[model samples]
Structures are given as C-alpha cells and as structure tokens.
Target: MSDTQGKDGLAAATGRFDAALARLDQSLVELTNRVQRIKRIEVDTQRLVQERARLATELDKTSARAKRLDDSAHDVSRRLVVAMETVRAVLAKTE
Candidate 1:
C-alpha cells in the first residue's frame, strides 16, 4: 500500500480503539454504581431483619404478661363469686 493509505488506515484503527476504550470506561462506571446501590440495599435489609427480631421478642414478652394478667383476673373473679355466695348464706341464716 502507499504510505498515505497506510497512515489513513492506522488513523482509522486508532479512532476505533479510542471509541472502544471510552465505552469500556463508561461500562466500568455503571458497574461500580450498581454495586454501590446493591451494598446499600443489603445493609438496609439487614437492619430491617434485626428490627423484626427485636419486635418479635417484644411481642412475646407482652403476650406472656397479658396471659398472666388474664389468669389473675379469672382467679379474682372466682374468689369474688365465692365471697358473695358466703355473704348470702350468712344473711339467710340470720333471717
């Protein structure tokens, strides 16, 4: 080939290479951004999971306390009924 043709060919090849490099750099930047977003999402998910566990534990304790209170109320009601019956019986005897 002539020298001018060779120079033109080299210049075309260099332009194509530069374009490809630019595309590669752009892709790398996009990939890095995506990875950072994924990391943030992972951290948020972990935080939520921890919060859920804490709430579950709190719920369990509350349920246990409620059950204890309910049992105590039933016991008190039973005693009150017995006392009322006893008082009625005593009044009847007096009469």
Candidate 2:
C-alpha cells in the first residue's frame, strides 16, 4: 500500500477511537448520576425509619399515661360510691 493509504487508515482508526471514548465518557457520567440519586434515596429511607421508631416510642408512653388516668378515675368512682352509701345509712338512723 502507498504511504498515503497507510496514513488515511491510521486517521480513520484514530477517529473511531475518539468517538468510542466520547460514548464511554457519557455512559460513565450517567452511571455516576444514577449512583448519587440512589444514595440520596437511601439517606431519605434511613431518616424515615428513624422517625417511625421515635413515633412508636412516643405512642407507647402516651398509651401508658392514658391507662394510668383511667385507673385513677375508676378508683375515685369507687370511693364516691362508698361515701354516698355511708351518708344514706347515717341519714336513715337520724330519721
């Protein structure tokens, strides 16, 4: 082959290599962006998990407090009934 033909072949090969490199670079950029988005999603998921745990703990404490209040109310009601009965008996004796 002539020197000119050899030079033309080299030039063509170099052009193809440059195009392949550009495509590879673009693919790498896309992959990097996707990875960053996934990382952000993971962080959000972790935050949500922590919030759920905190809310669950609060719910448990509030339920216990409500139960205590209910018990006290019943105790008060029982005491009031006994006092009313005693007053009725004393009144009957006076009558």
What's the lDDT for all of these models? 1.00, 0.99
**What is the lDDT, from 0 to 100, of the residue 60 in candidate 2?**
100
Candidate 1 overall Cα lDDT vs. reference? 1.00
lDDT of 1 by residue, 7-84 (tens): 999999999999999999999999999999999999999999999999999999999999999999999999999999
Positional deviation of residue 16's Cα in model 1 after best superposition, in angstroms: 1.4
Tell me the tens digit of each residue's lDDT in model 2 across 1-95. Answer: 99999999999999999999999999999999999999999999999999999999999999999999999999999999999999999999999
Off by more than 4 A, model 2? none
